[model samples]
Target chain A: MKSRIFVTLKNGVLDPQGKAIHHALEGLGFAGVSDVRAGRLIEIEHDENVSKADLEEMSRKLLANMVIENFEIESN
Target chain B: MRAAVIQFPGSNCDRDMAVALRDVMGADTSLVWHRESELSDGLDFIAIPGGFSYGDYLRSGAMAARSPVMQAVIAAAGRGVPVLGVCNGFQILTEAGLLPGALMRNAGIRFVCRKVRLKVENSQSIFTSHYDADEEITIPVAHHDGNFFADEATLDRIEGEGRVAFRYAEPVNGSARDIAGILNDAGNVLGMMPHPERMIEAMQGGSDGRRLFQGVMEGLIREIA
Candidate 1:
């Protein structure tokens, strides 16, 4: 089994990297780009016995800091 | 006072913290490795020093916070043992849930490294007793992720409870409310981005940082007495 965790800063949290990328895109003559928020994708390979609850625990404990970020898990 | 400095792999400031506690503050101090699940007994202070722990992988201080030694650290903190986390140590404390808020990337998108002025916010805590209230001091802050962030309610709560220990006198990083250091609700733990251990001696350009350790010693002595 495999899983993917998408970690992103919460909506109100300031994302400096995302802001810089947005600036660069605008400087490169791109139009209608309102905002950009950067995030991370973490891929994991695990045994089939790993339950969704276990994955959620992993995300809560380490994959995302609830203070400023949120994580979504997908499994296949 | 008896103290211990937790040393994670790549913790560059462990020696400096040990030196500050042992040589500068005249306390008996030891370096405890991260793999150890137990801490020595009768410790008055525990320091988590600054460094690229676990190479800042998966987020700064995330891995190190979950290290074996942290369980001991968390237990010690629960016992009201004084814990100080500097720079990456601050990140670790937040990740460990010992402190509120998280440190984010600098708003300027640059690594901030320099001596910056800080105002003592609340000098009544065990960590800030040596400094006068509202006193301005200069300390070196070197960090890529030093901007502190928290929900508005948390910010108001900490401020209302007088848990803010230090605030930047000038804009250095875009920290919320210019917070430079903060205390846990119990007032036994402190986490900050500045490296006070680096400014402990006059030869180190200033002795402002020495007062922090002195304050801790004073508080411990008061406890013993």
Candidate 2:
């Protein structure tokens, strides 16, 4: 199975890197960008026996810091 | 008194921490590597020093937090052993769930490296007993992801409980509530961005941080005496 996890800062958390990217875009003359947020994507290759529960546990235990971030797992 | 300074693979300040504890705090100290699953018995103090642990991979301190030695440290903390986490160590403690919240990028999105002024918020903790409450002190803070973040309710609770040990006297990082350091609910674990170990001597520009270590040593020694 292959799984993809998207880890992002929780809502209302400050995203400094994303804000910096927005600034760079504006400097390059881009417009209409109201807000920006940054996150991480992690892809995993695993055995077919890996279950959704396992993936979720992995995300909870290590992939995402639940205090300030959330993780969504998509596996097939 | 005896102390253990944990040394992760990328830890640069382990020796410095060891020296401060041994020389300044007058405790026998040893450097414990991250891979060691168990710490020797009779450790009076544990310190996680600052550095780019695990190369700051996955997230600052994420990988290092899950390493074998942290389990022992966590167990020790549960037993009321005093633990101090500085800079990258602070990040690791949060990642390991020994401390609350997470450290994010600085609001300015820059690696803040300089001596910063901090106000001692709680002079009652073993970590701060030597300092007067609200006393301002200068310490060196060198980190990229030192911006502390926690939800409003969590922030309120920590603040209300007086768990906040230190707060930035000036705008240095975009830390929520300007908290530079905090103690865990058990009051045994402390996570702070500023490097107290680096400022233990006059040549380090100031000895303000010396009192912090001094307090812990005195507090622990008193119990034994």
Candidate 3:
């Protein structure tokens, strides 16, 4: 089974990198961009025996820092 | 005093930390590698030095936090052993769940490297007992991801509990409450962005950082005695 995990900063947490990207876009004359939030995508290749709970555990334990980030797992 | 410096594969400050503890602080210190599952017994202190551990892969300090040696560190911390995490070590502690909050990228999106003024917020901690309360000191901070972030409730709780050990005297990083360093709930673990080990000697610009290690040594000696 293959899984994709999206990790992102939790709401109300400052996103400095995302803000920098937004500034760069404005400097390049791009308009109508309200905001940008940066995050990470982790792709995993796992055996069929790996259950969803295991994936969630992996995300919680290693892939995402629960302090300021949240993770969502998607299966394909 | 007997101390150990935990050295991850990419840790660049392990020697500096060892030197500060062994030579400056006059403690018998050893460098323990990350792969070592067991730490030497009877350790008075454990120093996790700053560096690009695991090349800052996944997230800053994420991979290094899960390394085998960290289990021993956590166990030791649970036993009330004093642990100091500096800069990247601070990040690792948070990732390892030894400390609260996460260090994010600098608000300016630049790697900040310079000596900045810090206020000793809680001199009562074993880590900051050498400094006077609210005393301003200069220390070097070098990190790209040193902006500390924690929820409002946690911030309130730590502050209410007087767990903040150090605060930035000026705007250096966009840390909440301008927190430069903080102690764990048990006050046995400290995670800070500033490098006190780097500022231990006068030749290194200032000796303000010396007191931190000395304070820990004295505190440990008192405990042992």
Candidate 4:
């Protein structure tokens, strides 16, 4: 099975890269732009024996930093 | 004093840390690779130096924190060994759960590399014992992600407990409350963004960083004696 993990900064945390991207978009004359936040996506392949709990544990242990980020696991 | 400088694959500052400790501070130092599961027994101090460990692949210090050698380092810290993490090392400490808070991307969205001023916060700790209360010093910081962040409650608790070891005298990286360095609850582990090892001598522009290693070595000698 293949799964994708999305890691994102938690609410109220500042996203500088996202902000810079937004500024660059405005400089390019893009209109009605809202705020932007940066995050990461990790794709992993595991045996079918792997369960959702295992993936969650993986996310908690390494894929996401619990202090500043949250992670969601999606199975493909 | 016997010290171990942890060296990750991309660690460029390990030699600087060893030189500062061995030559200036007069401690016998060794560079321990990240893959080793064992550190030298009876280590008085361990240092995590600055660099782009693991090429900063996932996050600064994230991959290195989970490497084998860190477990040994963590065990040593549990036994009250002094551990100092600078720059990327600071990020690894936080990632390894040895210190509180996460170092985020700089608020200005740029890689900061320059000498910045810092004020000693808790000099009573072993790490800052050589510094006077609220004394200002200059140290160099070079990182893209030195901005420190934690929740308000954790911030209040650590501040109330005097776990903060240093604060930026100026807003250099937009760190929360301008925090530059912090100590663990036991006060044996200190992680700071500034590179104290680099500033250990006058040729490096100033020698204010010398006292940090000096103080720790003295403290260890006293303990051993």
Cα lDDT tens digits, model 4, A9-58, are 99999888999999999999999999988899999999989999999999
- Report the lDDT tens digits of candidate 3 across residue range B58-96: 999999999999999999999999999999999999999
How does model 2 fare in lDDT? 0.94
lDDT by residue for model 2 (B1-225), tens: 889999998999999999899988899899998999999779999999999998999999999999999999999999999999999999999999999999999999989999999999999999999999989999999999999999999999999999999999999989999999999998989999999998898988899999999999899988889
Provide the overall lDDT of each model, using Cα atoms, as 2-decimal numbers. 0.95, 0.94, 0.94, 0.93
Please state the interface RMSD for every predicted structure, separated by commas: 0.5, 0.5, 0.5, 0.6
lDDT of 3 by residue, A1-76 (tens): 7899999989999999999999999999999999999999999999999988999999899999989889998997
The parts of candidate 3 lying over 4 Å away from their true place are: none
RMSD of each: 0.9, 0.8, 0.8, 0.9
Docking class of 3: high
Q: Per-residue lDDT of B1-225 in model 4, one digit per residue for the tens?
A: 788999999999999999999987688898888999999887899999999999998888999999999999999999999999999999999999999999989999889999999999998988888999899999999999999999999899999999999999998888988999999999999999999998888899998899898889888888889
Docking class of 1: high
> What DockQ was computed for model 2?
0.95
Query: Model 4 chain B, TM?
Result: 0.98
Ranking of all predicted structures according to lDDT, beginning with the best and ending with the worst: 1, 2, 3, 4
Worst 10 residues of 3 chain A by lDDT: A67-76
What TM value does chain A in model 4 reach? 0.94
Error of 3 at B94 (Å): 0.6
* lDDT accuracy of residue A31 in candidate 4: 95
Q: Taking the tens digit of each residue's C-alpha lDDT, what string does model 1 give over B99-157? A: 99999999999999999999999999999999999999999999999999999999999
